[model samples]
Target: MRLIRISTNYPAYIQNFYGQRSALATQPYAQQYQTLMADCYSWADFWTQAFGKLGYEVWEPVGNAEPMQKMWAQENGVSYEPKTWLTDIVAAQVKQFQPDLVLVNDYATYSRSFFTHLRQICPSIRLVIGWCGAPYSGYENVFKAYDLVLSNIPSFVTDFRTQGHKCEHMHHAFNPAILKRIKQEQNTPIDFSFVGSIYRAHNFHNQREKLIKQLVAATDLRIWANMMQLSAAELKLLPLKQQVYDLVQLLKRLPLGQTVLPYLPKLKSYARMTNRPGLEQYVDPTIVARAAPAVFGLAMYQTLADSKMALNNHIDISKSYASNMRLYEATGVGTCLLTDGQDNLADIFEPDREVVTYTSAAEAIEKVNYLLDHEPERQQIAIAGQQRTLNCHTFDHRARYLDQLIKKNLA
Candidate 1:
């Protein structure tokens, strides 16, 4: 069967590929930048590589140019309309490649009309599946355009199906080939580390801030924000806004601010900007000052491998279950995983044996300390976690599952 994988940053990948060869010869910094680019493209690269190994004729076309174009548009205060350029490119690829399936990892870039146009061009296309990383409340229309929708979150699958969409619970997996340990010296410097992006203040959902505050106070924790750039000027305003908000709250009890409290909504817009709240707020100032900038792709895996324990925290939206890529990536790299507790965690890893779970900030701190003290036990769990991931949760395992689902649907 023929398949065409649609990636959000294939254009950037292509540019980086050529750019690396020509510019990397003499520049020392070029190699580091190239590694970052590779990390950005690793998701799409994993699936393409996995399917190719299974003997499928996989063709990954640059389906969207947003990654390459967004920064320029943002800096100039302009908008990017994907439909203007993407539709023609995607239709042309469908017409020329005529693949049996078109798989999308980033569905937000493709509109309902774009898929309808692709269907018109190649009516023989068997299926179009999109992987969703979030809930489907506002995105039902987007999923309706696809024959199948896959999500790592189990609740999302149930929600999508209740809304009459064909959805499957496809859990996240690790690529052992991409994320293996490089030999490091016996002493790993970092005791505990957390690597992931912090959500914006507007979309705050998790208890990450609370956990980070406790951890920073208790242990030698390292945090790396997986963001492009965090503005120092914006961060400077947060405390002033927070102080004003606190004063306003204190005034509310005095009967004068109570009348003005209704107008607080108007002030909130300005207040939020000053607050600049997010994961940055909870992190200790010392840690934030010394924190290493974001690392991606191979460097991310290497970081996990070198750490004695890798911490995992799920966002608020993941309610009652853990569903983040870090669970697999950290454990797959043979690092002892210290993760938040979830009801379905045992379904993924045998907690306490393969992975360790924490219910509260105190527990997380206590476990981190205990695990750090007991090196042999921690190493045993890490080895077990890695073995379990290799046996049950690799990209090849997910690819095979997807292949079967496609064949069954086609048949």
Candidate 2:
């Protein structure tokens, strides 16, 4: 088996700044602190190299002009022209890699054009696959373009199949390396910790401040905004492009007090910004970049090693879907996670068994109290969740399953 996988946006470093158009842009404050980067790209690098072990060749488009960076930069006033467009470059990469299968992440707004160009170049490639999430609406058209579509949101798989498209449910997975990090750091203690975007929709910034004000008033609460790091002047004069070179320094966190004030006058507008509107052109690049795709890396480890219990509150937004890498990440790290229950969570673990759940602020506070009071039970739940992740949800498992799915679908 052979494959070419594509992702539109990923972090620059494990613990780097959020550049203007990147994830850092949305939550400028995250750049001020230490935020661990997710290792999805590392997963890509690992699995690609590991494919050789399975007697398959893999090629991924790497470097800056890689589709993700190029597309993101332009949208955020970072880069005007991407080094290469999807169709042309991918077609060339396919010819060079000579793979039997093609795997594409559902990042691009329009995937058909890319798939069509690829099929034109390599009609005998055997299979073309695209993994997707919600928004199965107009996707019936795109679904027909590929030989198969992998849906992480399994509930919608049957709907696509009904449209004469071959769709399958493939659950999300973690990387063992991250779990190892969790184990290594499980003993280290942190005060109060949270990892994710600070946008209004995801509510990373506001919720964090609220938590800090309440339970963590005296504790050391660290938020790794993971957005681009920038100076004071840059934050004030961003997107306007007043001084070209000076803005290049990059910035993340704005003073919490000052940042929220700007939003107070225009809470409605600011809230909408966090909600994520428009397409590649108008949408804030940082929202996509800084949110941390594999945000679970250090958070999981940190939650277990440093804190008594880690808080996982997803922003309530219309379009937002619970990424749940945090849920898996926290569990894998053996960190006691207290998250607002989301869709299909019970399928992953029993609410009070593998992980704990809460709906209201009072309940969340109560759960934290209960877990802290009962240390052994908390540890038991943590151990159970970690074992489950280690057994079934590592990135290695994801890659292996992906390989088999492609072969089976093609056959």
Candidate 3:
């Protein structure tokens, strides 16, 4: 079987190609796109490599840069009609290659007209699959354009199926080739660290913000309470404060929370209670300054490998399930993971064995402290987690499952 994988960075690659052939090399946008293409390493790489291993001829066509360039110009306040160069190139490639299966990853930004044009050019294309990461909030119609939709979010799959579209639940997986154990020269320096973005309150990160604040408080209690010589009353107040914070967070998730949300902002003094501080307020400034800046690609693997323990916080959207990529990537690299508790976590990893889960910040702190003090036990769990990932959660495993599904359904 022949397969074609479409990547979001194809336009950047095309821009780089044209930039090299003309004076466009000197343009600022061309230079910027070139840098981005160089840094781009994503799921397309893993999927293509896996399909090739399965003895399928794979063709990856670079998209036309004209539309992307026009979009960039518009973003900079210069209006221009989008060119059809990308669609033309894609159509020509599809007509010539005659792929049995075409896969698109996060292709939401592409215009509907382009997809219609693609269908016109390649009428006999066996199947077109769309892989989605987010919910089907704005992209419901986009999913209809594909023959099948694959999503990590179960709710998204159900929603698509309800709309009479073929959708399947495919969990996030790790690429063992990219995310693997890296032997470090120096010993692990960080006792514990989280390597994900912390967004503002307006986004769906309120749960994360609260959890992080609670963790910060726990850290302070563990490291600074004795140093600062707190009184008995202060020590007693710490747990009480955490309990109250937990109660408030719980109430926010209840139906009563939704009912009060509309009116909560109207009350002046009560509105302040709903406000959540940014990451700076929760984390120690000194720790933040000393922490390594966000790393990507191969450097991320090294960072996880060098850390004694890596932290993971799921967004509020992934209700009842641990559906983030971090679950696989951290464990795949042989790092002892400490993640927020989810209902379906035991289904993925054995609690306190293959991986560790904590329901609250205080529990996370307690587990982290215990794991740090007991090195051998932590190492054993990390090794078990790594083995489990390699055996059941690698890209090769996911690819094989997808291959079977395609053959069974599309046949």
Compare the candidates by lDDT and give the number of the best one.
1
lDDT of 3 at 62: 39
Name every residue pair that clashes in candidate 1.
Answer: none
Give the TM-score of each candidate. Answer: 0.76, 0.63, 0.69
Candidates' lDDT values, in order? Answer: 0.72, 0.55, 0.66
> Taking the tens digit of each residue's C-alpha lDDT, what string does model 1 give over 1-411?
789877565343445444645644334433433343455344745766789888888766554533333332343444435656465555666666788998887666777777888888888688998888754454557777889988988887888899888888888888876652345546777789988765533334337755775787888889876433336875687677667767765665677766876677866554345443444434445446646766655666778888999989887778688788898888887889999889999999999999999999999988889989999999999889989999999899999999888888788
Task: Give the per-residue lDDT of model 3 (tens digit) for 1-411.
Answer: 888766554343445445545755445654544443433234535766677788888765435445444444544554433454455555656676778888877556655565676777777678888887654365666666788888887766777799898989887887877643355533676667676545433334557656665666566311111011233565567566555555556666799975775675543333335543223233333333334444554555666777778888776777567778878878988889998888878878888899888988778999998998999999899889989888888778888989988897787
Model 2 CA deviation exceeding 4 Å by range: 11-43, 49-55, 63-87, 134-142, 158-164, 179-183, 198-222, 226-308, 313-323
Cα distance off (Å), candidate 1, residue 334: 0.9
**Which 10-residue window in model 1 sums to the lowest lDDT?**
66-75
RMSD of model 1, in Å?
7.5
| Candidate 2: tens digits of C-alpha lDDT, residues 1-411 | 677665444434423333322554334222221121333332344456546667777765532333343443344444232435544444555665677787766534445766777777776578878777534454556666788877765545766687677888776665566544444444446533565544432323445334433444433344444443444564566545433322222211345544554445533333334322222222134333323332433433554446556667654331133444566666666666677676766776777787778765667667777776787887787778778878877766777777787668766
Q: What is the full ranking by TM-score, best candidate first?
A: 1, 3, 2
The numbered model that scores best in TM-score is 1
RMSD values for the candidates in order, in angstroms, are 7.5, 11.8, 11.5
